[model samples]
Target: MVLRDPLRGLARRRARWLAVTAVGLAGFVVFVVAVAVYRLTAADPVFDRGDISGLIVVFAVSLGFAGLGGLRLRVLARRIRDTASENGFGGWLPAPSAADDDRRIDFGAETGRLRRTTRRAAALVLVWVALFTGGLAGMSLLDEAAGELLATGDRVPGVVLSVYDPGKGTPSMRVRFGSRTAKIVRDSGHHYHVGEAVTVVVDPADPEHVRTTEEQNENQFVFGLCLVALLLGLAGAPVAAGAALGWRRRARAVGVTGWRVATVDVVPDRSIGGRKRPPPTIHVRYRDGTGIVLRAVLSTHGAKALADFTDRLAWVGGWGREMAVLFPQGPRRPGPYAVPAAAKTPRAASAFRRSRR
Candidate 1:
């Protein structure tokens, strides 16, 4: 049976993700252009049913693609175990060199950083929830009140008798509705001159109740604000959740005791664009008690610190998608210095057990 190379698989996955991300971004640009053209060219720019439905579909599909691409990118950032290499014992014959015994690590500083990250993430989630809920409630109340007024009122043509500035508030206008004159606040951006004929909605049960066609449509501004709030909440929820999960995993890994000896290999960065790239990912491979070779990806900062030591090995610790490396001397780094495989094995346990000896 032919065995698959884990490194080769990772390369292929990265390429596929890059293509997917490009397509998603292209779709978003198209959606934006379509909206701008539609609004600018139309005489009455209000979105009809068909227009709204089509826009929603396009936006949702584009968002889904972008979200999927991001998820795949995250997966590629973590460390993965290479099981195929275990079958061939020859591949694990020579162990990597270890770090100097005098290496220093600042565990306290790292822990503090993680704590701050967790708190920030929690606070962001709460803020978004509050904004989304308040906006939705306010919009609902406004719509209900407007609906009631429209249902109980009658439409009639009224002549504007006079227009005056209220001094303390918006401009006001007096309109005669079938011999009964009532004062109303003029809607913003709408001008009313004396003797101008306008359509008014009035309730016979309450003679004082009067509203112009323009007034009824004024609620559009409030609706727009609510829609913005909802969109922000939707977009921020995923980002906050992802940050929380990542930090939590790092905290757990840092809490683990003991360290293991592992060889570090730098993965070639395949990121697009000519712009400067961030730190490259390092692959850490080690053999557990079962003699299986397990691999994990080191964090960006950790990769930078260990760049010169690619020819040698280093001291690694932690379990699952969270691991850290110790150098002879480098900047103080946080937990989750690296991410390992999810599969539970004697790999991490045995490595730590040996550290005690």
Candidate 2:
């Protein structure tokens, strides 16, 4: 039916978002690990060159991980639904009882819990990254300050490899200190030109440290790290909040039992609102004795979700099993065993006998 297509589309969209989030979290973790390894091992210049290839590898890994994660979630959803059916819940699954909340149904409370958990987990990972990056930046500044206090570095004659204006008004210089190159911003009254010989100071013990002005050369690196941390924190904050909000909404709906169930009698190809376009028209009849009728025109995605529920109803309806219907303005409705073929079944005959008893 038209319902399966829409449900499958929704599943695909969910998978896509899940994959993107997985990739982002994985990428950030990898970055932190790479930086730690580089600093701890004091890797050589070849390791620095390898950073470019490392980035390519990270992208490839992220894509691979995303694909695997998406497929896993889809499979999990299918498994949950199948398990619910086998448990004699029929084609429709309900939310777990409050006392027995460990049980889960794919389209109901279970899915909500999964989303909330995933969002919380992702948010926590990002918070950890932000803390780590901020700490690293702080440590870098503190170490530089200590180095200056100890006067450990000596001033040496170095050549300016290049002078580039980074559009910050003040020019920055890439100076060659012995065999190493360091980019240092020119202080007030200090001017530099390409290939010009300049006096640069270096730490004899750690040649990587070079000081020229009071404005810390390493501040730029710390600033960049802090900026990344801030961005990650910002992205994570809203996602966590939204997920929490969704959880609360779902909880309210589940607790209140406000929605009534209905079965789709027919899905019209044309819009019910007299529009020329197809407007997701569904003609459904209330399953309860009230004999209420409904014609719903919903969004594409909403239509898909409703169609899926109706498809389930059709399967059980064929067997004369009563299905639940969710109504727009009334109490939940129970379906009638309107199909005569269901009455001929041995199970139905036995059920009829039991009802009389």
Candidate 3:
């Protein structure tokens, strides 16, 4: 079937989103400039509670619009699932000829490309693991160093002589321990008043080094960091393993050739975080000579580009888990591209079609 301006609606949608995004960003910039001017011209430079609240409200609204517009733009780029139906084309293409049935396309290049992509993804995951693990190790080393310092140091009663704030970091204070006066930076979140009586751990070898008992007891921050690192590792390990396994599978299926005639259906995109949505996926369902029904989900941009073929029977080629839908006379006359796919049951596939309607 031929289409005249099939993407007219999509083009209009994109233009509208572009305008909205521009307006939102412009509004945010204006708000920022206005706030800056207000602060500069006001008698009191500091913002009051009410002024802060008003600024927050404007910031949130402008940010929300900009975010919504950006998300809509992405959704438009990803959405092709309902293009045919929306454009008033709901019929299948003609059946393939006997020659088309016998034809097979080499998928060696596609398979290699998929393998490389998977390897890169695995490498990225490994990097993520290293970064988080390194952070955890660094924090652990710091904790150990602190523990060692407290272990060998002498505990002595001290009086805070004076406190000085550098305005950027933790406040430093002068404490008198017997005849020695040591200046020590206070632990984060700890407050010390001048002339306050406190117990201090003093390093015998270096009288200038000292820490409060409270500083040694505040291991909670370190523990929290370790916990966060552990959780991040747990989250990333499976993704890395999956990518590695996927690469291995593609490597084995490098030259494998499998073809089948499949009926296509566009799977609707679902909302994420109420406003954002992932790209739509295409579902191809077919039966082999053995009478078992199989479904493959194609999520690649190339596959989505073939949305005009929805509800039509088309040739599908597979190389292990990766598959490509053949478009003999596509708009760009592009070659078939290997798309990441997963298997599903026929019953579930039909349910998806029904739901899309």
- The candidate maximizing TM-score is 3
Give the residue spans of candidate 1 off by over 4 A. 1-60, 80-123, 154-157, 161-193, 203-209, 217-357
Query: What are the per-residue Cα lDDT tens digits for candidate 1 across 1-357?
Result: 112233446646756885787577668756864565444333246987997898899888887887898788667645323222242212222232343132454555655555566677778878776776666566566655555667777889999999987667557788887878877766445787889998888767875666776664324457668768856764665556555655655555444333555555543344577442435444444543222222333332335444334534554544333444544344454333433322222233233233223
lDDT string, candidate 3, 1-357, tens digits: 111435556756877986887687767867864664454233235877997899899899888888999899768744522453343321111122343353344444545655676777678678767755664565556555556668888899999899888877546788887887877756545688988998889768876556776564324456557657755764665556555644544443332333455566544444565542333455555442111122234232334554434675555543213334544444355655544443332223243344355
Q: List runs of model 2 lying over 4 Å from the truth.
A: 1-152, 157-161, 166-172, 176-199, 219-226, 262-357
Ranking of all candidate structures by their TM-score, best first: 3, 1, 2
Worst 10 residues of 1 by lDDT: 87-96
Provide the global lDDT of candidate 2 against the true structure.
0.43
Q: List the residue pairs that clash in candidate 3.
A: none
TM-score: the better of candidates 2 and 3: 3
lDDT of 1 at 310: 55
TM-score, predicted candidate 3 vs. hidden true structure: 0.43
Identify the leading candidate in terms of lDDT. 3
